[model samples]
Target: MKLTVVGGGSTYTPELVDGFARLRDTLPVEELVLMDPAQDRLDLVGGLARRILARQDHPGRITTTTDLDQAVDGADAVLLQLRVGGQAAREQDETWPLECGCVGQETTGAGGLAKALRTVPVVLDIADRVRRTNPHAWIIDFTNPVGIVTRALLRAGHKAVGLCNVAIGLQRKFAGLLGVEPPEVHLDHVGLNHLTWETGVRLGGPEGEDVLPGLLTRHGDRIAADLRLPRALLDRLGVVPSYYLRYYYAHDEVVRELGTKPSRAAEVAAMERELLTLYADPSLDGKPALLAERGGAYYSEAAVDLAAALLGGGGTPYQVVNTYNRGTLPFLPDDAVIEVQAAVGAKGASPLPVPSVDPLYAGLMANVTAYEDLALEAALHGGRTRVFRALLSHPLIGQYEYAEALTDRLIAHNREHLAWA
Candidate 1:
């Protein structure tokens, strides 16, 4: 099978390449295309991708191009991992929101809305091109604000499923803690993308015994530390929230802390520079361990599993993915995209039934779903008022004054990306 990676110039490409190389038995790629506009980074990352494949003795031929059409044409599946304005823009997304006394995060709050405005239009255009060239290809989106982007793709009638490493990362961590393989650990991962909670962790199979309580009892401190949340909160919630929840659960404290440190984008920018330098070296064939610090942990495994399942090849039949809720959570609109365990196959991913959520989590999910509706409206139909309304709907920016100020800052900083601005 042939596969395409749209944002192939990203420093994260090698980690993906490494996964394709290591998991050849699952996907068996024949040709891999890396498409990006950034030529220098593309060359560096592409060279490393080739080296990685060769080292693993994978038969797949690697190709690099700046042309989107060429990269996606005749592909079996396409993965979207692009950053619309790159990390420099992300730095702005992660900083300017702080000026409004809000948490400066890339995928939540006003910053996330800014990213959605910048990204959705570009992704839709790319999806249009992909459909024209290869209507049969599945678009696996790994982009941020995935729920919004995936909703856009589905609304526009594209065959797409949103992918995130958070579910897989947590799954792997749980597996390690349980001394089992990653696939054997099924997470009851639910909620919108980035904003999710692990209500259950089952072993052996989806219906297997729940091991979450045991994990919490044994490793709550470590897990809480990893999520940067208090252990007490985990005990009270009786579940683990994704690390992204840190921005919400501890908004003020996080804002205070963000004020004392460089934005994550800045840290990642520096890391990407070093990673690129490493990629430039002809001797580097394997993905560096430092890439772990770059985030998206176990992304390759998730991508491979999802791709293989979607392509109807041999792989895990069930995994956690972001797809239409379809009433799994009756509180959410059926059209709303949610991340949860699903039975993935050639027919596409169908979410498994979730046990009813606690009011504590369900209330937040409902609120965020409403915000997502407004956010997508703003993304699809650009207007300052739409943007303002979207921000106002967000729980994190519910105050009209903060919403108004953030709307202005978002438009001002992203004038070039926002056509209406």
Candidate 2:
């Protein structure tokens, strides 16, 4: 099988390369293409990728290129992980939203909306090229604002599935807590991308008995601490919300904390510099340990599983992915893309039925669903009013004044990225 990574120069590529090397049997790639516009980073990352493969005795060939069409032509699958604007733009996304007293984040609130606007068009163009060059190829998106980007790809009628590390990260965490293998812990992870909750933790399979209550009883404080939430809230809610939800559950506090500390983008920029320096070393053949601090834990496993299943590579039948709701959640529109446990295969990913959602979570999901509708609208058709409306619709920035300020800030900071502006 052939695979193409569009943002092959990213610091995260080595983690993915390490996974591909270790899980070669699951997704036996014969040709792995690293396609990036940044040739310098691509050369460094590509060299490390080759060394990783050689170390593992994997025979797959590594190719690097800046030509999108050439890289994707006749490929079995294409993974989208590109940042439309680099970390410099991300720093703006992470800081400008703070001017409005909203949590500065890359994938939520005003910042996330900005990322969507900048990312969707570029991804759509690439998807168009992939479809033209290889219609049968599957598109696995690992980009931020995944819900919006995946929705754009699917709406455009591309063969696509969205991938996120959140579910896999949670599964690994839970398995460690429960003293089981990661695959043995099945999470009923549901909701839109980033905004999701682990409503159930089953063993063996999806139908296996739910052990969530027991988990909470024994490890509630630990889980709550890990999530940076209060144990009382976790106990009361009866579910574990993704860490991303901390922006919602504690909006003002998070905003205050963000204001005090440096932007996450700043920290990541420093991290990437160090990682790239490490990649430049000829002796460094394996993925650096510090890459763990860069996040996206278990990303390789998730990507390999999803890609193998999609391309008839024969892997796990059930995995967590972001796909159409298709009534998986009665509350969400069928077209709404949600992250949940799904039955994946050569046909595609189909979300599995979720247990009934509590009103507490349902209400928030519905609210965010509405905001996402507007966010997509703003992303597709750029305008100040559309931007303001999307910001106003967000639960975190519902007030008119905050929305107005955020909209202006978003347009001003993203003027170069926003064609309409």
Candidate 3:
């Protein structure tokens, strides 16, 4: 089957290419298209992609282009990984929120809203184009602020599913610690994208034995260390929170730490420069080891598994994905997008039933869902008021004064991207 990657020029592309090469038996991609506006970066990444596939003796053909329509036309599945404003815009997103004494993350808080506003429109336009060219194609979104972007695509009636590496990354980690194969570990992963928790770690299947307690007893410190959270917190909560939760569980501390370090975007920019220089080497046929430090670990495996299942190919029956809640969480609106374990297939993902959620986690999920709803409104129908309201609704930035100031800073830093501004 033919597959397309919209942001194929990203430094992350080589890692994806490596997965496509290694997992050919699962996805069997025949024509892989990497589309990017940055022609120079596209050439470097595209060349490496071709070499990776050839080195593995895979028969898939790799191509690169700047034309969005050409790249998506007739593809079986199209993956969205584009950054609307590049790393420079991300730098702005990661830094300006710090001025308000808040978290400066790209996927949450005020900065996340800014990213959502900038990303949703562009992703919708691409989805529209993809639908026009190939209505049957599935849109697999790997973009940041995935919940908002995927919600926009689904609301606009596009065939789409949102993918994140967090679940897979955690699964791999848990498997290594448990001394079991990756597929043998199943996570009772639930909550919204980025903001999720592993309520249970089951083995064999969704109904298999829950080894979470044993895992905690034996490897709590290691897991807590990896998450940068306190082992006592994990013991008290009795659930493994995603690393993203740190921004919430330790907001002030995170903000203080963020203020001290260079923005993640800046570090990534430097890494990308070095990665590009490495990609320029003709002899480099594999994804560089340095790419692992660039984040999105196991992204390729997640992408491959999701795409394969969506296309009626080989993949795990149950996997974690972001899709319409459809009452998986009794408290969340059915239309709200949630990340959870689901049975994926050609028909799409249906979230598996979840046990009753504690008020602590459910309350936060409900709060963020409301914020996301407002964020989507601002993204779809731009206005200063909408921007302010979304920020004001966020649990991380609930104060009106902070919201108002952040709203102005967001628009100011992103005026060129916001059409209404």
Top-lDDT candidate index: 3
**Per-residue lDDT of 192-269 in model 2, one digit per residue for the tens?**
999999999999998898999999999999999999999999999899999999999998899999999888899999
Q: Which residue segments of model 2 deviate by more than 4 Å?
A: none
TM-score of each: 0.99, 0.99, 0.99
Error of 1 at 209 (Å): 0.6
lDDT of 3 by residue, 1-421 (tens): 9999999999999999999999999999999999999999999999999999999999999989999999999899999999999999999999999999999989989889999999999999999999999999999999989999999999999999999999999999999999999999999999999999999999999999999999999999999998899999999999999999999999999999999989999999999999999999999999999999999999999999999999999798999999999989999999999999999999999999999999999999999999999999999999999999999999999999999899989999999999999
- Give candidate 3 regions above 4 Å deviation: none
CA lDDT of every candidate: 0.93, 0.92, 0.96
Q: Note the residue pairs that clash in candidate 3.
A: none
Error of 1 at 299 (Å): 0.7
Candidate 1 lands at a TM-score of 0.99
Instruction: For residues 134-236, write the lDDT of model 1, one tens digit per residue.
Output: 9999999999899999999998999999999888888888888889988788888888898899999988788899989989999999999999999999999
lDDT of 2 at 185: 88
Worst 10 residues of 3 by lDDT: 105-114
- Choose 2 or 3, whichever is better by lDDT: 3
